[model samples]
Target: MSSLAYGSFCATCCNLIPPETEPLACSTCAKPCCWKCAREPAESVSLFNAPAVICVACDAAMDLRGGGKMVPKPPMEQGLQRCRMHPERFLNLFCLTCQVQICCDCFVVQQDHKRHTIDSIEEVYRQKLLETVEKFREIPKRLKLVDWEAVRQVEENLKIIQEMETRILGDIRQLFQQRTAIMLNKTAEKKAVLQKTKDFVDRTEMQHRQTLESIQGLNTNDFLRLQAALNERCESILKDVGQLQVEPVRWDDIDCDLLPSCKLQPISLNLPNGDAAKEKHVQIQLIDDCGIVWTTTFFIGGQSLALEMKPNRQLDEFHFKAIVEMSHSSQIKVSGKSFSFKGFLAKNELISLPKLNSGGYLTDTGDLVMRLGIRPENILEESDLLKALLVQQRKLNSQLKVENATLKDQNFILRGDMLRVSSESQQNKETLETQVVALTRRLKMFQHNSYVHNQTLQVRPQTPISPVSQPEDDKEKLSSDMQMLRTKLDEMKTSMKAMNPFAIGSFEIYRWSKDSKFYSPQVASHVGVTIYIIVQPNFACEKSSDVNAYVCWAKGPKLRCQIFIEVVNEFEDECVREDRVFDFSKGTSFTWKSVISHYNLFRSDGFLSDDHLKIKFGVRPAVE
Candidate 1:
């Protein structure tokens, strides 16, 4: 370290360490010197590890072993030299066998390793480096080829699988459609069967209802008599109890155990009915335990009848006949009577005649009771008989009640059967629904497989194989020969409307007649001249003449005949007149139109619109 001293006199002072305390020699010179005048020694260039020394006089360096200063030399002077045996003077080569650097002369002329390959040193180095780089560059291309080959195989397999899936799915779809159709058909058939069963049940129920109603109404008179008898017995018992000073008891409760539950037996019959129009006769005999017997004889008109009776049935072999009067109003009477044949049925009877009432209304079932002598002439006797008939009525009422209960039980069973059928139908419906769901799921899976196959086929490249395999050519031909059935379903819905009625023009009457015996002949013509208008054969036509009218013209030589009618004058003598207009435009084919005139044409009273003249037309011609 050197120190600089400063003082008030402004003179510079240098400080230096003495060698005894610290080394003050220069690093380069190794000489003790004052700080202000010290100099650095020159650098040594020796290639030896000896301590360096410098000459201060010449400022030169010397090696420790007395050698000169070191200097960096060019390659030619240090080591790079041409081979001795070759003419080349450069060393830019390699010894191939020895793998050592050499000049071109050594590479070509060295006999010991002349057969080995030799090249420029830089060229060999570059070639080895390029080879290493190229080897690394080829790896990705090889890997790509492997990947493409594997992908191609995978795609081909997928394509084949897809084709198989497509075929299978097509079959599945067809099967589903067929099954759906079958299910629908089965459902329809089941519905039809159900409807038929329902109809049967309904019909049976109606019959039961009718039977119950009939039973309820049976022997109402008998029940009344029994009630009266019961009341009389109760009254007598009450009187006896009063006499004994005892309390009256409830007879109904006391006798409840003794009273048996009544039962009913249905009636069966073999009927004897013959054709009424062909002079067939009917006879019925009713006998009671008291030997009171009744017999009836009847003659029928078609299925309808006119009947006569001997109400005094105790007579032996009574015979009677009647004047059979028939009417168009569904009313026929041997004499004035109203009767029905619905009240005379008995259980298990072989009736020899169709049941008939004195009143004449027929029933499909011949259950009519003969209510004889309903006329006012025999009212008293008929009343008495009706009264006497009430005695046996109570038994009929009990029988009817039991029958009704049995029918109700039968109806309940039928309802249970109906409910069970409905439940079965519902179960079938649910099963069908489940089947549909299963099919849907299978279809979806098939669709998914098909999609996957399609994707594979799209990505895959084709192979150059023949369509048919060599061994399967015959089998493929069979596929080609399969029958192709093309089915076309056509549905036609047709709705039909009702047709309008046919219309005809007004009626035309060519001729008419009027006589002196007629009263108010013109008014009679107006009332009786029915213009039978035909709107249609089935539809009734309006009788109004506003539709059209017609006139009647006489058909004769020179048209001299005019339509006429006879009328009475103030002198009570007969006069011929033509008063009304013979309108034809208002006439239909079935309608009639007429105008009246006198016996001669152009008579004073023969005006077409005059009164006191009658006109009529029929199929018959004018009478003489």
Candidate 2:
């Protein structure tokens, strides 16, 4: 036996195989070979040459049928092959031209297949074998190049995807950090804003509590107004918070309903198991949102009371009186005035006690001995002295007012008399001037009469009976009347010369005794003697006199007189003056003013038990 060791052999253990066998065989075994063992077989070779090479047993089966080696098998013998005409048999061979395979029966009998060119099993098999070998040789190189290119492409795609994924992850991380920072900052800002909001709400609620307490003890229009204002502020705060852009986390805490509710109850110290005593001195504290507390006292009768207490502190049962006072320093006259109420906690109501008779006395001490259930008339009567004093003061003030009015009337009459006297003197002088003019005309007429008589005497050649012709009685009567008229005129002139005008000067003093009139006696004397003349060219002037002077007691020592007269009476209608004699002899002061139209200056001395003398002076015009 021989082996074919070169063609299509399994490339291992070739030395153990034999050559020159018709088919390759195993070198180590002496068995007939088919292609599986002959080409590179570990067996004996067979002695057959068939187109489709096979083992000896397989070749012999073909020879038993015919001498041809190209015998075909049934269609089913090949995988997925079936006879075309027979529905159950697969037609295996495919014809390229006719585009169909034929079974052995069809080749012999089918009319469609009889005229077509046919390919035998050996011819088709050989042609297919060469084509298959050519295709097989080119497929691996092309596949290898394609696989390498696919690997490169896959690597490039994976790298790009990896870079993009990294960038996306980095962006996501930075975005998360940025959002966190923003959220944290906003949270801090919101907390600060919320704190402020809480503070404001707290303050407003505190104000509401204070106002409510005030309304409890004292009910007034002012307190009511304050309460309304507080309510409005609370509402405004709530509305403002509602309009905020951010939703607050802890808004419920500031709700007024959730906050403390306080009511004023009579603190009864007389409860059982209690050494009952009224709260004699309690401190009233006013708290703000900032935790600052202001301490004040609520005084009732002579004792002080408190309004609020700490939350944790115990409230001892006690009954105390309280008086709340509020002041507004805006009214001009009534700023420091007080509104007082004497009240005690009776049952639950605040009962007001009767007012004391003593106006200035704060409380009735004797009323302490009188039981709460009883009213003491004796204490009420005991306070009568103070009440009577008040009444007496009122009466004395009325009398003093009446006396002052009487003095004012007397002064007015005196001033009226002066004005009348001055006006009468001026009228008298005008009348005298008119009378003088008439008297001159009358004298002229009398002289003419005498001249006419003398001329008649000269023309009648010395008539010698003048004693017999003249009426002596008529002449004597005329002379007597003239002498009386002249005497009356001389008396009028003397009276006009005696009437002098003067101005009043001013002086202010802090203290005025009962002998104030005596102290300034020289003032009155000067009023009668020294004349005060004001030279005012704008107005009608009586006489050009420079005796007007001023004296002010408040000036102390450096008192001097500077007189002025009108100069350049056009645009500059002002007075120019030089200092004259400064007189300080008249009780260290002296002043005068022209008594124009008989105007007199009068003084009012305001005297009271509570206050020192306050005086005022004025020169009033005559009523007439």
Candidate 3:
């Protein structure tokens, strides 16, 4: 036989060996391998009849062993491959920080992996595979529970949406019903007023026809006798017509836009006195939605009475007063623990009603009811009206003169007060500054002393000189003093700010009315400088009414201001404007009258729109 030569290389170590030396060959891969690189056949491979050793590579290549022919393992099951960056080395470690598999070379040499936490791939695989299998097994149950919860949530949300929709729809319908009721009530009121006017007109017409017939049938002698009476009757009829014309039954313009509705709360009243006969005074109050209170006080005497009506709150622009005579017939009723008053009210006159023991014409929930009628004697002649006008004008002029004088006095007082306050503020500021400076100097001295103490202690550690506890004590005391000084300084600064007079602020603009005259609230600036405007309605005046603007220097130093007044139209672009420069010195308030005509304010083609008079005011410091 030819000498056995080294034929094939061992599959495990790839070493050449002699065939005659009986080198092991793998049954699966048919690769020759050295004895150290061989492994016994699996127990399931009993058909081979004899035990055989296979090369390590052939054993590794077989994924499922023993029962069948060699089956190659999948790429994933072949363990970690070489790293992409460094193909020569196998990827043995996983980077926890980077979440990537890296070889030993990449982990040790690459800058990117320097800070990354690395774990062996086999260990990570063993942990992650078991966790993944457990999680995979739980997926179905978790998905089922999540799906059920989502469905339940969807159902609940749908129910809530439906309920909200129902509630909103119900609210809308209720609002409409309420609005309709209000409209119906207002219509009925208008109808009643119109019916009353119609009845008055019919009665007057019938009387006039009867008088004309009597005049036509009268003889010359009778006519002369009745002429004076007939003339008086005619004049009375004409006066009635004029009065009707002056106060017509006209519908008030209603705004369709919705406004916040206020509940009609019951008005609380003070306990009533025993009876109208014995009571010396009676008070009645009416409060509006805007918190305005109108009070009427009745001073009762044996046969005479005085009624005083006024606003509970002080008004800036206008005041109201009415003087009237009371008739003996005016009376009050008290029964069932309720108070009721009924009286006939005329211009400067009142006729009392009969006292009721149990019941009377007690409207307004048995409160007070006044069925007042104008007395015929209240009518005035043309000459009398003229005289009244002249008297009113003279009264207003005299009142203005007096007010001007009072304002001058107030101005002088304010000037003195301002000077005193300034002096006090200056003194307080100086005192605080001096205190702060002294405290700062003391704090610096304490710090210097402590530093010197610390240095001496450092230099003379063995010296018998007791460490000066005084420096530490002094330092703590100085720090506390500094803190107290800071607190006092803050308080002083706060007080100074409170004393400042030039600060500016604003408030809400409000509308008010008295005796059919419209007015604006007194709008004041931060320094207590204020302004208000009034529109006075006068049927007899040339322009029907006069608009006035008042500027008041209620407090603070004298100021020169430019005041701009505008009447804007809600429906139109055009507006009526007036501008004036006024010097408000001392505590004087200046009034500018007849700045604009009332006719222009109320005219259909003018500034008033939607029955609303929009007034705008612009106040600025006047140029020197």
Candidate 4:
């Protein structure tokens, strides 16, 4: 009999085994075996592509599936445990008082736990198992809820940061635009003044060049003929040159920086151990640009929390106070520089911190952070000061414009006056030259006559010498005439000096308005007095109506004088005059009660033309 006829079998049993038996060859024992004597390989070794079957003796060396692998059982599932102190005995009882498992032998023998309460271990395990299952059932739902809330909070914080960044950028752009506009306006004003001065200088320069060319080329005979006209033109040019003088521009006039000195910045501080949420007392101090110190104290706790701020020094321009409500309230008042707000904070409602111009921020850790914002008071005051200066400068510029216009008018008048003086002087000079020529001819004739008379007296004794004595008398009269001419020339120079253009007083023309019941700010003036005229159509007087005029001597020599006020209508060639004697020692103002009646002064009578009245005043010594 062959080994194959016997089939696979257990060597020890020596009984015929089933042909389906999985046989394993033991590498260590060098023997063939069946599944009953062999085991599966561990998972670590079975992963590789190797023989599936493994014998028990070669289990550590070979790879197999679902064999030789041990599955650990939880200790709680174990039927019972031996006591720590009494290892030989099984712990069948649980001591409630000592909180330990005990063997029956130890519970009976140990003095410490002899009187403790005890229960069966199976009963205690049943109760603890139910509690653990219930706790495990709630874990998944609670974890999902926590995860959702964390993600939502993260998204909300990100959105807030984006909004703040966008808003701050927009504010910065707007601020820059405003500053740019201010600078542009200032530059435009400065340019206008400079342009006006340039135009005047150009015109004057052209006139001067023309005058110089006219004087440069001259013919002796032509010059003598046009001497009076030439002198008048030169005088007029000199008067214009004097009036065209303008002051140079100064640095102080246009010195203004429109940009803000300080910038807005974010500040933050962290409190230690959530102390801000508890009853914590915090005092914070802040200093401002004006060197003012502000202190704020926080009393946080319970249902009520108070926040108080006080300044080390009191301020007149700005007053500040703030109140924070942790609990629900209808309204709360918070003080600020320009405006005040009343509102409530619901739960954890977010609020943008107030921006203070000269104020500061108080932090939880008693640290004060000063946020530099636009100083409202300083800005307002500086704006006001600049506006005032601008207004004054504008007023001065307008006055300068008015004065320049007046000077131009005076220059024209002076030109006319100088032309008249030049004509007169030229006439005088020509007349003097003619007189000198005549006197030279007369003296030459007298010398010849005297010589003839002396020769006749010497040659013929009979001839009379009376003519010679007569010539001596005529010579004395010529000397007296020369003395008178010198005296007249001296008087003319004194008169020219007295006729100063600046010394002449001025007057202004004003129109009365019945609708507004106010004087027009647009005042018309002539050579330094204010002429307040009222057309009183409704005036009650013995006469039906009259023109009332008040004379205010604003600037002039203080002297007792009689002012002759005249209302002249040049087109109509009509005139009305009144004389008022005023003692300037008392006052420089005088009212001409009724200079003229409405009937006599109205346009119908040709006294007022084109709704215009010309007022003229002449000052003279009261004695005269």
Question: What lDDT would each prediction earn against the true structure?
Answer: 0.38, 0.39, 0.53, 0.50
lDDT, candidate 4, 1-624, per-residue tens: 011111233432334344444343333433334554334434555676654544344444533344533323324325666668877556756889988887656666678777789775656777788899888987987898989999999999999999998998888788777767766777787688668867877987887788667767777887788899978977886787666544433222343344213322222333233445466655666544434355645454443334444555433444222222111111121222221212211122122223221223333343433222222234555455345546767999999999999999999999999999968866765565556556556656656665665676466544274645554565566566656655655554444334322112323334433322222233333233333433343334332224655544444345655565566655535567777766453354454444434444555665444544455555544431
Residues 1-624, model 3: lDDT tens digits: 011112334656766554445444444543445544344444555356554443365453322224333334323325557678877656757899988887766866688899778776655887899999999989998999999999999999999999999998998788878878877887788678778888999999999999999999999999999999999999999998877632222112232224322222222222232464445666666443334465656555444334554555444333222222111112322121111121222222132323421234334333443321111112232234335546767999999999999999999999999999879976876676576567567657666766776787567545347555555566677577657766765665555444443323222223334346555554536334566665554444332333443333445457776666666655546666776777667655464545555533444555433334556665555432
lDDT by residue (327-356, candidate 2, tens digit) is: 111111111111221212221222221221
Order by lDDT, highest first? 3, 4, 2, 1
lDDT of 1: 0.38
What is the lDDT for 364 in model 3? 39
Q: Considering only N, C-alpha and C atoms within 3 Å, which residue pairs clash in candidate 3?
A: 325-348, 329-352, 329-353, 330-352, 330-353, 345-372, 411-586, 411-587
Candidate 1, residues 176-199, lDDT tens digits: the string is: 777667667766775776576567
Candidate 2, residue 587: lDDT = 51
lDDT of model 3 at position 240: 85
TM-score of 2: 0.19
Q: Report the error of model 3 at residue 117, Å.
A: 14
Tell me each candidate's TM-score.
0.19, 0.19, 0.26, 0.27
Q: Candidate 1: deviation at residue 141, Å? A: 99
